[model samples]
Target: MNSARRFLLSFAACVALALGMAAPAAAQPFPLTFDAGWNGAGSPPLPASGFWDVQANWNNNFQAGTSNNVSPYAYYQETAVIGGDLVNSVGDLIATFAPVTVNVRTFQDTLGTSASSPAANRRAVAGVLVQNGSTLNIQSTGRLSVLVTYGTNGATTGLPTPGTGSVAVESGGMITIQTSGQLNVVDNIDINNGSMTVFPGALVTAQSINSGAAGTIALSGNASLTSTGSTTLNGTTTISGPNVVFNSGQVFMGDSTVFNPVITGGTHSIMNVNGPVTMNGTLRPQITGVTPTLASSWVLWDSTSTNGQFDFSDDSLTDLPDPGHRYNVATTTVGSVHGTRGLLIVENFLTAEVDRATGAVWLRNTANTGGVNITGYQISSASGSIDAAGFTSSLDDDNFDGG
Candidate 1:
C-alpha cells in the first residue's frame, strides 16, 4: 500500500513538471519607491548607481496618485547621479505629494555619440511635469537637460507641446552647464515667481518666455538669455540689468516692454529683437562712455505697420548724441509718420532736440555743424524754432514731405 501511494505521488509530480506548473515563480521587477527609508522612517539616501529607467532600482508606485494616475505618494529627498538615460515611458514624470529635493547629475562620457542617443548626458527625453501643489527643487553643477512637453505620457520618443506642468528653479539654486550646454524648452517659460534665477553663465534656448504679469527678468552680473527660435511675450517684460545681452530669433511683444539697461556706448553686446516691437512702455537708453554718444544703434525696431511709431513719451537720453552716427529705427513700409505722441526727447550736451509728432519731424538744435539727420521716413511737420547754438538739422531729401 505504501509503494502504491509513492508511485502515485511521483506520477502527479511528473505531470505537474511537464505542464510547467512546478517551476519557481519569476521575480517581480523592483518598483522605484521612496518610503521614509529602506527600513521605513529613516533618512532616505540615493541608490549607489543604476540606470534611471531600470525597474530594479526604481519604485514606480511613487508616481501613482489622484493627480497622476501612475503611482502613489512617496517622499523623495536625495542627491543622486545617473549613469544611464532617464527615459520615462509612463505618463508625465511628476514629483509631488512631498517636499522633494533632488540634485541629479548625468554621466556625459557614457552618452553615445549620436545626436539622438538616448544615453546623452544631462538630457531627459521625457517631460517633467511639476504641479499638483508640489515643488521640485533641482540644483546641478553638471549639465541638466529636460524636454518640456504637455498632454502626453512623458516619453522620450517625440517632440513635446505646452502642458500644465511647470519647472521652477529655486532662487540661488542654479543649473550650471559647462562646454556650451544648451537647455531647450519647446514652449514658454515663466520666471515671474522669483523662485528661479538663471545664472550668468547658464545658456537656455527656448521658444518663448513670459515674465509673469508683474515679474521682472533682472539680468544682473552680465547674465544673458538667447532664443534659438522665434519667441512671444504676453505680459509686462522688464529688462533691468547691466551689459545684459538678450538675443532672440524674433520677439513679438504682445504687451508692454520695458528696457532699463546700463550699457556702454560702443559695446557690441546689445539687445537684439528681430520682430515687430510694439512699445507700450518707456524705453530709456542708458549709454555710458567717456564721450558717450549713442553710436552703436542698439535698439532696432523693424515694424511692418506703415504708421508704426516709437512713442518715447517718457524716454530720456543719458548720453550725448554722436553727430556722425544716426540712431536708426529701421522699418519696412514707407508712408507719412503717424501715431506718434509725447516728446521724443534726444537731449544732449549740445542741447539739440528731435521730436516726432503726428506726420511731422521737429528738430530744435543749439549745437553747430552736427545735427539730427532723419532717414527712411517722410518728415511732414512744419519747421520749428531754431535755437541760439547755431546748430543745424537735416532730413533726408528722399523722405521729406516738404509740408
Candidate 2:
C-alpha cells in the first residue's frame, strides 16, 4: 500500500465517527419540568418524566405514575378520574360548567394487550371543557365517561384499563387516541339554543377531539355557558379549570350526568374555578360508600361569590330514596343532635324529602337515625320539616337498602 492510500483511509474513518456523534437524540412529548409549570410561555421540549404541563392542564382520578413528578403541580380545571403512582403535585381543574370525575386506579398491569376487564372498563366521567398555554384548547363538554378500572382487588390479572378514549357527545367532533380516550366539545351546549345528547360509549363531534387524554381543554375569554344536563339529575355535575366562567344559568342537581360506583365526591372533590360562579342543586355533593354506588362523589363544586347566584330546589332531583327507601335528609349542628335550617328544614334528627324537580321540601324516612349534623350553614330560604324517630344523621341504607 502507498502512504497516500493509508492517509485517506484514516481520514475517512474520522469523518464517520464525527457524523455519528453529531446526530440528535429522539424527541419526546411536552411537560419537561419537575413542577410541570411550562413557564407560562411556549411549551419546551419534553422529557420522559410523564407530564402534560407545557401545553395545557390535566385532571384524572387515577394516581398518575412518575416517581420523578412533583406529585401534581398546579391544578387542571378539567374534570377527570385518575389514579396511578403520583408523587407530590396539586391537581389542576375547574367545576363551574361541569365537574370532571376521576377514579385513578392505584396499581395494575400496564403491559397488557387490552384493558383489565369488560365490566372494569365501562365507567363514566362528566365535566366541562379544558384549556392551557396559548390556544391549545381541548373541550370535553357533555359527559366523559369510560369503563376504566384497575385489575387488582378480587380480580385475577392486574392490568391498566386504558378504556376507550372516546368523549361521547352528540355534536362535538371526535378523534381516536393512542390508548386512553378521545374528547368532544361543541361550540355551544345550551339547552335552549342547542339540544343534543350523546349516549355512553359513543363518539364525539367537536372541532378538535384528540386521541390523547392528557392535554388542554380551555374555554376562556367570552366562553360562557349555562352548564345544562342530559337528565334532570345529571345537571349538577360541574368541573373545569382556569379563569373560566359559569354565567347565571349555571346550576347543579339532576341526572343529565352520572358517576357510577359512588365512591367519593364533593366540591372538595378537587374542583377548581376561576372567574365568577353560581351553584344550584339538591343531590348529594359527595359520596363515600363501602359497597359502591353510582351518581355520587365530586371533587369541587364551588360557588362562593355573591356575583354568582346559587339556586337550590328540593325537587329538581330524581332517583333519590323514596318513602319505602331507608335514606333520608335532615340538618344538624356541630355538637347538637339536629341543628336548624333557620328556615330550611331538617329539625334535630328529623327526616325530610327534598323535591329536586320543584324545589319543594317534605318529610320522609322518619324511620332512621338522628339528622346529619349541618356543619356551619344557617342561611335559609324556607325552613323544612323532619320526621322524628328513626331520623339518623349517619347511615347509607336509606337510599339503596331495598326492603
Residues 1-403 of candidate 1 have per-residue lDDT tens digits of: 1123323543554476678673322231011112210111112454533223222233322222212221111101111211112223256553322323333343222323332222232134222332222222322343334432211133322222222212333222223333233344444455443323445554555566655443345443345676655544433333433455576655554335444444554432345555434544435455556354343334332322312333443335564543323222333333212221121223322222355232233433333334445443332336754332443446544322221
| All candidates: TM-score | 0.43, 0.23
Tell me the spans in candidate 1 whose CA falls farther than 4 Å from its real position.
1-141, 148-182, 192-196, 219-224, 234-247, 271-274, 289-403
RMSD from true fold, candidate 2? 21.7
Q: Which runs in model 2 stand beyond 4 Å of their true positions?
A: 1-268, 281-299, 303-368, 371-403
| Per-residue accuracy of model 2 over 44-73 as CA lDDT, tens digit each | 343322222212223222222222212121
Tell me how candidate 1 scores on lDDT: 0.35
Cα lDDT computed for each candidate against the true fold: 0.35, 0.26
Report the lDDT of model 2 for residue 134. Answer: 17
Cα miss at 389, model 1 (Å)? 36
The TM-score, computed over Cα atoms with residue i paired to residue i, of candidate 2 is 0.23
Residue 132, model 1: lDDT of 24
